[model samples]
Target: MSDRQTPLLGPDVFARRQERLRQELITRKLDLFIAAPSTNFQYFAGYNPGRSERLIAVFVPAKGGSVIVCPSFEVERLTRNAAVQDIRGWEEQEDPWRLVRTALGEMKPQHGRAELALEHTFDYASYLRLAGVGGDWHIQTAQPVSERLRIIKYPEEIALIRQAIAITEASIAATFAALQVGMTEREVAGRLSEEMRSRGAPGGGLVQFGPSSALPHGGPGGPKLAREMVVLIDAGSPVEGYASDITRTIWWGDAPSEEFKRVFNTVHDAQTAAMQFGKPFTTRCQEMDRTARKVIADAGYGLFFTHRLGHGMGMDGHEVPYLVEGNETRLEPGMVFTVEPGIYQIGKFGVRIEDDCLMTETGLEVLSHRVAKL
Candidate 1:
């Protein structure tokens, strides 16, 4: 069982979030920001009413308070949990889009400035209805506004992430200790999942053994674990809506081959170099990617080092402020992300070392220290 404590978010937190979103709307020149049934909606509404063919939305107007429009059956659940006072519901036969239109019209948005921003997860069919009802109001993606607020970690969120990481590490350690040679990749993955769930994790993640590790996202049913073969386990779990992601590659039974040792060391060094370069307010997000990529490229494994160096982590396993090429977003204090550099050789083996890190005033702080040594 995990000894780490999970932090709780109260109504005040949601209130502050709504206020911040309202401020962002004004600053970004958006008239109405709409979040459907997704993380963005949960971030403000304090609950996820789930997604469906029916329309469920939260409208945050720039000049006034927010409102939630859901099916009549869900109104009571939302009312109990959501911070927003305005709750509008529609019955089975009624058109929910009309309710959304009524809510938007009530906002009294000026025609020329009636710009609507919808979350990326908003369904396309609903978008059509909302767009038609919105008349001449401009429609755009709300990712910028919502991602801006979610990329930075609050203290409570960090606490949950820490607990998730601890639980994930403990489960991985247990799984590794119980692993036996000749076990199938699926068997090992099942054991890992059971261990993680037992340790209070919501679920487990990827597990690849032997040559299957060569595929970055290798499917199950690959070769069995054997002596001197590489084993890669990339797993995580949720702690109170927050998430933890980590990847560790290890040799199975006996000592690894010289080539395996060299590749592992190179990948490890790349991850270290990237983390060291991730300073707040100074380093661009892509710099971390470049730093790690350069290390692998210099080691003559450039082509093998496919995919981005890492990605941001939070309520969702992967989010904004991605550590990849062409992302110019500057790192800031309270920003958290992963630093994972890997090399994949088809029909051979792969090595990946991933860890979570938080950007602080002084520098970057690594959050997961369980599998630092290969």
Candidate 2:
């Protein structure tokens, strides 16, 4: 387990996040940022009021205070958890869009048109409504703003992610130790899920066996296990709001095939190369992907090694700083992502060794290092 204590994300944390975002707004000349009920909303608002057909949003102004708009019935519950004090509640009979328009009008600049940055998750219908309400608006996506702040995690966030990986690794080890020869893939997946939840992770688990393991994402889990078969288990669970993802492949029953061991070793080598080379403020995302992909390609499995090397992980399983081709984003300290390398041969077996990786001040630290490899 992580030596760091569990982080208590209270109003102060959210307040600091909002202040940092406001500075971004000033730099980008964005007048205001509006977030719908989503992860982005929760990040800035200090709490999520749950999803509903009724409109709910958080407004962060460039120079003024933040506000939250929600249904009248939810105001009481929202107030109890919301970090922002200005809460506007609209009744079912009233149009929530009007309230949004009024809030935006209050934050409008004195000279130019109001430039609004809407969160990425806002639907088209809502966008149209917001656009139609009154004055000239310069509306655009808030992706750049959100990505700037969230791409690099805080120390507390890293601690939570580490805790999550520790829990998931323990769960996977316990479940794998109890496997039998005749168990169905579904049974194994269920057992893994139970093990994760029982060990304080309430997320999900996935399992694949033998021929089904050839598929990268996954396939049906009805196939029964047997001797000389391949087994793949991809498991993840959340600690607090942070997430953990890990993939491990094993040779079940009797392991006697030279090909299976070679493939596993190749994947292991690829992951090691990428993890070792990733440095803070030095490596580009595409460079990391190339480092891992080249290792597999040199081993004569170029075409078989499909997909990107890794992706960013935090509150959402997949976030920013994706380690894929053509992405030139530079690596930074406190960025948490995965380093998963795989080689799949159709109609044969597949091998993937994945671990959550964190870039620290000096080097890349594999968060899932406690888990053993092939």
Candidate 3:
């Protein structure tokens, strides 16, 4: 039983989240599970890593709420912000693995054996260390179960995501208004981040621009925005631990070439098509991605549309239920993510329009407005 804490959420919400995890474990036939700071710690535990070295391991049993083995210093922080019931602490001087071993013992099954599970991004060293001490355990690490649990969003999570989307949209609009042909991409991006910071949004995203856009993640600054080049901005804001990602290709000049207009409209249309039928209980993301990719491929920039349509956006910037080929996760009402379809011509220009979208009972609602083309 959880104690009554002012910062804690109601018991029902926490139990509901825990119940979902139990179902995922049962479906995967697991006895015990562990996850590190990346997705497992971020979404499941509702905690972000301040440093890469601060590893967090979450343990989920076949039944009951999970136990977290985190550094002793984080106990107060966890109790204040998260809703976990079983909190295990570890000291830096002592090997953290011992604490984990104890927690796993508490949830021990009848056979003196436990099945281990992990998120795809779990640290290899951490796994080795834990497994070294973990004898008689069938360690199962893969993508299937983690995918099911994280692919969709819940209502409370969606609310924070919507807030993230709102802040990101304001930053994009501000970025354009603050833009000048002579100003470098770095300068523009700095201004964009400042706008969000001023508004109390802590976690910001990339402001990659100009030739930078050519590199996919070419990053910010150094080059000036030329007449024909597009200023591609990929930015986000974190609200209540949920992150919203939005990318828009902004043109620097008023002289929009026919090709430019055509590409922009195509990308825009692709985004619309992918999000068209997004709703509760409809989880067909492969079809949604195909719809977006086909538009770019048919228009003759198939190779240029290099990346997948989008990824799941939630507690972390990226999560499960990825929007790409070979993925079968169904879209659900509470699930929110981006629909970005791009076509980049090497040494030329690339166009990608991204907008945060939520699957609702009625269909889809664009969380942020489409960035206006100049």
Selected candidate, larger TM-score, 2 vs 3: 2
Q: Write the per-residue lDDT of candidate 2 for residues 54-169, one digit (tens) a residue.
A: 89889999989998999898888778877889999999999898898898888888897778899988888888888898368789999999988998999878888988898888
Global lDDT of each candidate? 0.86, 0.85, 0.72
Error of 1 at 200 (Å): 2.1
In the range 43-156, model 1's lDDT, one tens digit per residue, is 876767777777788988888889999889888877887778999899999988888778878885755668888899987888888888877778999999999999998888
Sliding window of 10 residues with minimal summed lDDT for model 2: 1-10
Supply the TM-score for candidate 3.
Answer: 0.86
lDDT of 1 at 205: 75
